[model samples]
Target: MSSVRRIAREEWRLWLRSKVVVAAALIVAVLIAVTSILTANRIANEQAQRVEQQVAAEQTFFAQPDRHPHRMVHYGHYAFRPPPPLAVFEPGVDAVTGQSIFLEGHRQNTAMFADTKAAADLGGFAALTPASLYQLFLPLLLIVLGHALFLRERESGTLAVILAQGLPGTKLALGKAAALLAVIAMFMLPLIAVAAYSVTLGERMLAAFSLVGGYFVYLCAWGAIVLAASVLLTQRAVSLGVLIFVWLFAALIVPRFAINASSAAVDAPGKIESDLIMLAEQRKLGDGHNAADPAFMQLQAEVLEQYDVETIEELPINWRGVVAAYSEAELTDLLNSYAEERMRLEASQSRIFGLFGLLSPTIAVSSASRAIAGTDLATHHRFLRESEALRFGFVQALNEKHAAELDYAIDMNRNADEAARLRARVNASAWQVLDEFRFAPDGADERLGRAGGSLGILLAWLLAAGGIVLVAARRVRL
Candidate 1:
């Protein structure tokens, strides 16, 4: 162990003496700092903005003047998907999938105002965020600075000299790994500070720690791979080429391939296509706007029989309201069914991508980071589902008010005259019956559970790399 420490100190001395290596490290450190601060500020600003918008939306809904219940249904509401506390660390899919949804009767809207288009406006490399730096650039930096670790020593015949002095090969290997770990820690300082500050953003210590830990494991795995490559390869140039290729393949190629593979595996329908299908299906159910349509004649007959009345005019409740409520319930079910199918297909695609992690630790760490930060597809879907629930409940409450409160005489002639329309409107106070929309994210335990598979794969990669380094170290010779 003492020998290992001495060798590690010597390696550090070499790094400090190399001007190019030192300059590169400084550049990365500065990038980490800048990206962290900028991202933090952006997240804080968005969070505050979303909070204000959500409040305004709620207030506007409750402040509307008396209007027909169906009118209130069309008036609708909005649900803003708040940024998770740790979103500063990992934004995940929020950039592309959007952040706010418009909730109204009989229609389910996709999220709007995603940052993807704005990011493109800035430039493609605008994604040079802190998370991207960790996942892609840091390892490349390591390969550039340290790919010659063992190869240079072997080419200079230092291995024979060191062995001649009775120093074990394992110590040299472990020592080089220690030096690389120190470098990794140096690059991780900005991230570590961000993680600590993340605790203050929310009571999510488990998630924050898990996030940092995943990155740590990921970087260490790279370190181990670099060590093994340096020793196993015969020439410094060859080692550099192989390590660079590995980095590119693991970080870039594998992820893209996984995405393509997943898309191929699951032929999920596009949004417009899905909407067209749903609209066609809805047409088959008849025009909900017209209760007198032959398609709803059975519903009218059922309502009349249930109320023991000869006609809709003599029935107890307003016929339009009953039809409105029934049609909405059916339509909502249709929307939910489609939503469930879409979610299932997406989930399947995600699973297929996760399986590719076996080929690249980068994929594993990326998945785990998003999952633990509560910014993955699952979280986004949770927001959509909860928002839809709120929409349905509010719409149904309006339907109930339309049935129980409005006079049928006024409803049938609501458009007949301004006076009749005025008579048909219900008090705006009725909207107060609906509770405000508040998204409840999954618990920390659930997030950790979801990330368990990726974490396991990362651990496996680390162990395999470590094992290769250890076994190869034992056989090291001049």
Candidate 2:
């Protein structure tokens, strides 16, 4: 223990004396601090703006004057997903998947207002977020700092003298690795502070801890790989080159390959293709606007038999409203079926991507970070589901008002006479009976559960790297 401490202390002193090392460390630390502050503020401002927009949308909806219930359905509503607090660290798919969706009858609109799809008036270098900084550059810095940790001593004969004096190779390796880990801790100070800030956001303690822990393990894994390469490769230049190549392959190449592979493996339909297919299937269901269509004729017969009435006029309810209600229910069922299939396809693609984590710790840590931050595809899917539920329920409620409130005679003649149209309108107070849409993100426990697979992958990487490091350290010689 004492020998290890002495070696680590000496290594630190040397690092402090090197101008390049000091400058590099200072620049990264400052960037971390600046990015953290700016990202946090931007997320907070966007969240506040979305909240205000949501409130205004609800107010405008309920403030409408009396009108036909079907008209209200076409008027639609907007659901703005509130960004989770941890999004300050890992905004994940938030920028690309969009922040809001439009809800109306018979159509499940795609989410909109995505930052990526917005006007590109700004520079294209906006990918430099806090998560990117940690995932991509930090490991490269580690490689540059420690690629020659023990190789330099071995080449200069200091390692031979130390071994002659009875310093076991394992102990020397442990000491040097400790020094490297100490440097990692210094680099992680800004991340730790970010975690602490996240913990104050109420009920995010577990997520915050998971975020910091995942990154720590990821960096530690890199440290082991670095030392293993440095001690085993003999030549410093060879070790440096190999480590840089490994970093590039793991961080950049594997992720892209995995994405392309998953796309090929899954073959999910594009938006336009999906829309066209849905429209074709909908045509088979018969036109809802034509009450004389065979589908509606069968429905009318069923209603007449149920009520034991001879004519539409003798029915106790407005026949038009009943047709509207039936059409909506059938349409909603069709929409839900397609929506579920799309979500299932996306989940499969994500699972395929996750399998590649075994080849790259970068993918593992990134998956875990997004899951912990509630910014993954699963969370976005949850938002879509909640919004759809709101849309379906509100639209159904309006259909109910349409059937029970308006007179059949007035509705049938509404298009011809202004007086009949006025009589067919349901009171605007009907919208008040519907509930507002609010997205519920997963709780800490749920998020941690979702991240479990990726975390396990990271653990496996660390353990495997650690074992290689130990064996390679043992083989280190004069």
TM-score top scorer: 1
Q: After superposition, how far is residue 150 of candidate 2 from its true place, in Å?
A: 1.5
* Model 1, C-alpha of 241: deviation from truth (Å): 0.7
Query: What C-alpha lDDT, on a 0 to 100 scale, does residue 420 get in candidate 2?
Result: 75
Cα displacement (angstroms), candidate 2, residue 264, comes to 0.7
| TM-score for each candidate, following the candidate numbering | 0.97, 0.96
Give candidate 1's error at residue 127 in angstroms. 2.4
Which digits, one per residue and each the tens of the lDDT, describe model 1 over residues 90-190?
87887878899998899999889744425543664545668888999899888977798888789999888987888888888998998998988887777
The Cα RMSD of model 2 versus the native structure comes to 1.9
- Model 2 over residues 1-478: C-alpha lDDT tens digits? 4888878888889889999988887888788788888877677677777888888889999999999998998899989997887877887888778899888887889899734323542564445668888888888888888888889889888999988888888888888889988988887788888778766754378788888898989898888889888888889999999999999899999999999998899988855568778997787777666666777888999999999998888888888778877887898788778888888888889988988999999999899999999999999989988998888888888878877898887878888878778887999999895587666568989999999999999999888887887787787776
User: Weakest 10 consecutive residues, lDDT, candidate 1?
Assistant: 114-123
Runs of candidate 1 with Cα error greater than 4 angstroms are: 114-121, 124-126
